[model samples]
Target chain A: MITSISLPKVEKKNDPSLAKFIFRSIRDAWDYRWAIETFVTNNLCRRYRRSALGFYWGLLGPLMTMITLSVVFSMIFHIDIKSFTVYIFTGLLPWSLISDSAIEGSQCFVSAESYLKKLFIPKLFFPFVIVGTYTVNFLFSLTSLLLIGMVLGFQWKLSLLLLPAVIAVTATLILGMTILLGVATVYFRDLSHILGVTLPGFFYTIPIIYPAESIPEQFRQWFLLNPFYYVIDLYRQVIFKGQSPPIQDWAVSIALACCLLLAGLVVLKRNEQDMIYRM
Target chain B: MSAEIQIDDATVRFRIYRNPSPALKEMAINLFTRRSSGEVLEYYALKNLSLTIHGGERVGIIGLNGAGKTTLLKMIVGIYPAFRGHVHVGGRVTPLIEVGTGFDLEMSGRQNIYLNGTLLAHSRQEMMEREKQIIEFSGLGEHIDTPIKYYSSGMLGRLAFSIATMIEPEILLVDEIFSTGDALFVDKAAERMLSLFDRSQIVVLVSHNMNHIEEFCNRVIVLHHGEIVNDGPPAEMIDFYHTHIAGRGSNASTEDRSPMNTDFSVASPSTAVSVQEQSRFSMTSSLSE
Candidate 1:
């Protein structure tokens, strides 16, 4: 592995082929697996370090958001729908996973200035840590939502068996986006600020608060263009809607994730060496 | 399968930007106007440097500030990629540069031990095995559970030092992290460092301390303005470096003399002794060794 040994790892000026870049990257990640584990643990620990509620806050925060949004839309706005709390809960959970991870991941390299300056850490390691930490948090909220949804007269379907696959696809999508944004943010520090402003726009436009059908028929095609909508829809199909999504949806979601991941790897490979000096 | 490092015709250039990164607004404006958003001051940090260190060579690198001393160490560590030429390293490199650098302040001293161990690419089980030794050496005791942010600088240094030294390095790279902890801890650290040096196949030490170079290194490379000015035995290189580089540079300005003199007293107690006279004693002793 590249991280384990220092020899045969020549530092040259030319960029390697994409296949070479990916192969070496995976080896580096595997070699630094313990680091990823430690960073994720530290990240989660730091989040709840001084909080009185601790890990319970992870469960309660989403529950409280579901309640507030359900009350606002169902009771106040009177936009009546069946199992509305569970519906929004399903949508908001995945949406938060994507947006929150992206916002944090965009600054992963910039924030790791201290570590990067001093060691030979794999460039992909930071984004992997972000994705790992967020996925754990996502799983926690998912468990709470499942119990709460069941209590609210929502039926569980065997389609829930597909939830793991859905999460894999979504997490893959987030990891790709995180790596891409993280590398870009190193060269352009404004990318994180841009994400802060634009991610909320994504939250509004991606139909997280309302069902996809709620969009007017003329403007609905734009929703199909969004890469995130497919991943979120995959979750809603399995968890909230209690039905198996079409194979085409699965194909599209997986393909989108693979493409982003490829792009992210490409950008990272090209800029990996230059990134240290840029920082 | 001994350790080796070959840096051939390597040129590491650094670009210092007036604005490190361009803002989005500035980027957009530059795109429209076809204007450069910032002025870049580019220069070579390591200029056409070619050097090779084989197994069992305890090499010392010495130079004035901005002479690419640390840059050379970092380049070999693969932290700084060369802009030109090739750098081929032939063993596991363990850089002791900024030992406690990436410690998470919010984590406890014990937790940081594992965190730092993993960062150095040691496995969890490996760290677990050394956990007792590390904690005992750090001497943080019950304070190991408390967040490291609350620890005094000396305590933090001790913890960082203990964790960093717990490695069986094949090619050890040291960059002046010697002066940590109190007198007692420094003695312990120096002993540990000497043993580590003895075990490594290749050792490259970068220091302004002439005494350390004379004592520990068999071979010495004197870097001047990113190029190797002299490469020879430790005593000879130290004498050449002091007269040609440090002395000339110091005479040009007094600010450069302090770093060369800071650790010079360990070699000789008398302030009246000249650098040449001090090196002459070591020349005879090192030749005999």
Candidate 2:
């Protein structure tokens, strides 16, 4: 007689528990640091497995680029070589780091679609791996640049102590941009193609090959608007000019990097679950 | 006492995007055309469903293709979020969703063992200690030093299965994973899974193979249209599954009702009764089996 006809209704809450959930996810991501490192290492080593040189190929690209740049701008252009090699090398070092990181970051999630779909691991680590692997390549190029600088008789400046601070700021800026572009590239596949064309043009505008002073006085302030200008200028000040970067430049660069990083984190957190749908 | 694993009214929905006519003119016209401003179409992959899996319980999920069985397993593993409810898993969950998921094809198997083990939450030192055992279980011998790209699909599956089950996770989630390898490896893998079940508190397996479900799981749940149509002992649930398939005009004929034999050397005793039932339903083999 007591045949159950009705089932109990489950109550639904209007408010979503988004904040606590995101916080917990970030904490979980931070706890998986070892897995992130292994992923990066595996990706880097996987690219050149069939090559006889293995990882030595990491040095090939930057070395060739540095040699080509030094030859064209210094030799053909008849630019002064007194301290120009050191200056150009310094600028190229950070430029390659930012450019390679950006290029790799833009393609990061798109390339790892299989792994991303299959695993619940943190997505933020994908871009980190891109930047981290390129950082290793950048350091390899940096070592060669330092040797060239030394051979060309450039003296070590006391301001070189600020090198670590400069590197930290550059890394922070690159990290922020990488995260933004990486996530955006997932939705707009054309973003990578746009980056491919824009990077070379943008490189000339940055004072990598030429100093900011080379631009006319009327355009000096406009050149400062480029973030890479400040980045290249920081390296120039420490390695070439033998003086510390002004406090304002450091403050502004750090602020810009942190702002970009915060914005990227917000976008990533909001889109994390929906990312699979987009992919 | 520890809390048991509970799936509280979980639902999963998928949005299927349909492209407009492929003609350029049609695509351009559709781009300019607007109908409902905010309407979007979606398909329910898994409807609201609840199940309580207690400690020391082995439950098998069986369903036809696209029945949301894999979606349920992914939800339990935390890879997919439920649209409506929460999956409160009580302990560490190892999802054997796909073989070689995290393996680096360019990395040597020996190196990948450490990498894959770390992703499974094992420390470097822990992987180091278990390195020999993992290699031996994989049976790759000296070939373990070669990059995984050279491995056949079976070898890769064996290696992945070995590394995954090596860890003592509290819960194991397997999704048709045993059907990957050769007969010998399958037997070995099944034995490993059985041993793991003895130690783990909960095991949830999703497979369309009724024999596997009946052999490994005490309880089986049959899903249809993302809803649980049957939930009970494996024998009854499997019968319901076969009936549902037969009703759908499946080609499971009485002549096709071969005995459930893993090795095919001897017929399983249960298969004899199943074959007898199939003969009675042969006319409706297109209806009821």
Compare the candidates by TM-score and give the number of the best one.
Answer: 1
Q: Tens digit of lDDT per residue, candidate 1, span B1-289?
A: 7888998999887665557798988889888998776556555678899999999999999977667777788899999999888899999999987677667777788888898899899999999999999999878899999988798777887888899889899999988867777899889989999999989999999887789889999999998777899999999999998788877843435523544423321211122234334333322322232
Of the true interface contacts, what fraction does each candidate have?
Answer: 0.57, 0.20
The Cα RMSD across the true interface for model 2 is 11.9
Best by lDDT: 1
Give all candidates' CA lDDT scores: 0.82, 0.71
Model 2 residue runs over 4 Å out of place are A1-26, A47-54, B1-3, B19-41, B244-248, B251-289
Tell me what TM-score chain A of model 2 achieves: 0.84
Worst 10 residues of 1 chain B by lDDT: B263-272
Write down the lDDT that model 1 would get. Answer: 0.82
Model 2: lDDT to the true structure: 0.71
